[model samples]
Target: MSETATAEAAYYEHTLTHRPLDPVSRYTPHPGLAQITSKLLTLPAEIRARIYHHAFQGNRVAVTSVRGCYCGSVATGPYRDDLNWMLKLPRWGELSYEVRRAFIGEALWEIHCEKAFEAFVARFRYLSNGNDALLRQVRHIKVNVFEIIRESWLVETNVFGPALRSITFGPWQKGWTIDVPNAVESPDELSDEKLMVRVTHAINTKHGYGFLKEAWEKGRVQRGGWKALFLFPIRYHVKQKDGKKRWQMQTWRADLDEGVIEKDWKDVHLVQEATLD
Candidate 1:
């Protein structure tokens, strides 16, 4: 058959191997907890796939010319949360839209996404090993399930930038199993909280997360007092550039109001696809 079909079949075969058929019989064997978690994540995975399919299939401009690491149009519904978190990635920040798309590729990359889940599981295992004693006895960490939901859900946006030159779609390692250390206590230095903060800061600064200095500068000319009146929130603030500090966010509210951005601002971007439930 076609290469796409062959690839798709291989992907499914791999998934089945990881997640054995449920309701094990004499002929079937039970899978591990890690396998179970991997399957659970597939719910979101399928939802994300549909978004990509719709966008690429429709051949929408917003999907093709997006500025940042995101592919397809604005995500809607359940997929919004996943898209938001991706935008916040430090590696994504470093990548332009073209580079990001190349990394993700056009076809389904279940294996690549699986590797991310695997890494997350490994980290979770590390924490669980340390708190195993407390977790075994405790029933609940908090009361509000909604709060948990809110914390995990984040919104994302896609903006077009430079393209990537080379792409690697797999994890740093492949098919490696992590073993929790025998020590009863976990290292405080392995905290993910600090890792996330540092990653986010790096992305924001390195990728020009907040605003485009070049765009703002070009947008500010030939306006009388009108330009100054508009870009109030985005003043000529100093930001690091090329290992040295420089003026960024130079435009004001007035610059945006009657400034360089296309008149049909809404039409400039499009919502391509989304998933919520």
Candidate 2:
């Protein structure tokens, strides 16, 4: 071969053997590191649930009636220290739904009074902007039912009815005693439907017109009627074994017994007329 051609062939062989690395491939993440950075959605559902539960444990939201109006605020750091850290998670929007479900579903909502409960509902509606997605996630609520005389219309509202799974009826006075028996003496013996009837009867006896049958009628006449009668299929039991008779009522979404409620409604009206007479 000619000297010039020989030199050119040698240059071509060197170029072919020592090609520069692609810039993108050079910066690619390690396979192990990519596996280590797996997303929350990639984890098993049970594991993700545990993570969400741990992240929001011990968090609380207090809704109090201040000057006859309601104000809702998150508990301070001592009570909800995890809140800040949870909010600071990377790519918040990606996990917003799961995070919110965990946060609201687990937190205890302390509503100081009936007024506070009403205000909380109003504020929740306003914040929701006509969407009940956030509200529906609520599972627990504590409210003072000692002076709830006007009727618990809000509890049966379409937006709040199915959302609340637990309702606690507590005394307004700090040290007052509620002399009420457990509606559920034996869970295995009594069906949910029977427990609901017992609890409804107890509440009606305790606070006449509080969970009134007339409220259902009025509600039906309003813009949007209630979904069920008396937050049906509820199981009631007392809490705080140390002599504080705070009744905690747990409800399930089941078919309501309209025939029973209608009969009770008639009975309530007759009693009211007799009292007036």
Candidate 3:
């Protein structure tokens, strides 16, 4: 776990709302809700685990990395209206509430991608009571990057860092493959990944997200023109060429703790992994 740039500062500004002294009073449990919770708790432990397992296992969710407080133009992309919105998780608060409610009902924490998890944590960090009760309940927030910029996701996870979880970067797209830049070659000196994963890892664990500014400044010279400066790190601007290239839709099942991420061909695949600088 590495410290954020803010950690270097003695203190923080733009403070978050603090929990009231009588924080217990904040939650007025509904009688109906309490009754239901009580009834569920009364069920056998094995039965309860099964119920939770059913809720999370293999559920397909649309993933989004919300770098901004609000989703703005890209408000979580597309989700199926079906499944009673079971796992679409369009809003950060909905997912956060879902996490807290599930944990309070029965200690189940379904894992999520790094971006989704950080989005949840970022949304609720200030009010976290002791034990990180909400965060602990988080297993993973499955991400479907949805043709988004690579830097967008990187900035998201860095906002929270290891204050979050394993991130399982890409069962969505081969964990972290989406963000790792294909343009650069790794010098012999440093060897995390030949691409952006290692750079992102360093910025996250060592220097903090601020490294993006420095990184972009260093590389902007190589970028083509003003348009590139406006979107310095977003590598995918125009869609692919060659009539053979077309979007290949993928289906997914949620893998539990195995943390499987598969490769989808992209810039990194253009060259052999062996020859990568």
Q: Pick the candidate with the highest lDDT.
A: 2
Error of 3 at 14 (Å): 35
Expressed as tens digits, the lDDT of each residue in 189-252 for candidate 1 is 2233432333233323422222222222444332211121111111122334555444332111
| lDDT at position 192, candidate 1 | 37
255: Cα error in model 2, Å: 21
- For candidate 3, write residues 1-277 as lDDT tens digits: 2343342121112111100111112233344643544466467767766765665443333222334222211212232222233222334554435533453233211213344455445544544653355444444332222223343334243333232332322222222222323223422212223323433442344222332334345442232111111000122112256533233323222112222222231211111000000
Model 1 TM-score relative to the real fold? 0.16
Tens-digit per-residue lDDT, 136-195, candidate 2: 777665444443455433344355545554443333322222222553455442454564
Clashing pairs in 2: none
| TM per prediction | 0.16, 0.45, 0.32
Worst 10 residues of 3 by lDDT: 268-277
> Model 1: residues >4 Å from true position, as ranges?
1-10, 13-169, 187-189, 192-277
Name the regions of candidate 2 deviating beyond 4 angstroms: 1-39, 69-80, 90-92, 147-154, 161-163, 178-209, 212-277
* Candidate with the greatest TM-score versus the true structure: 2
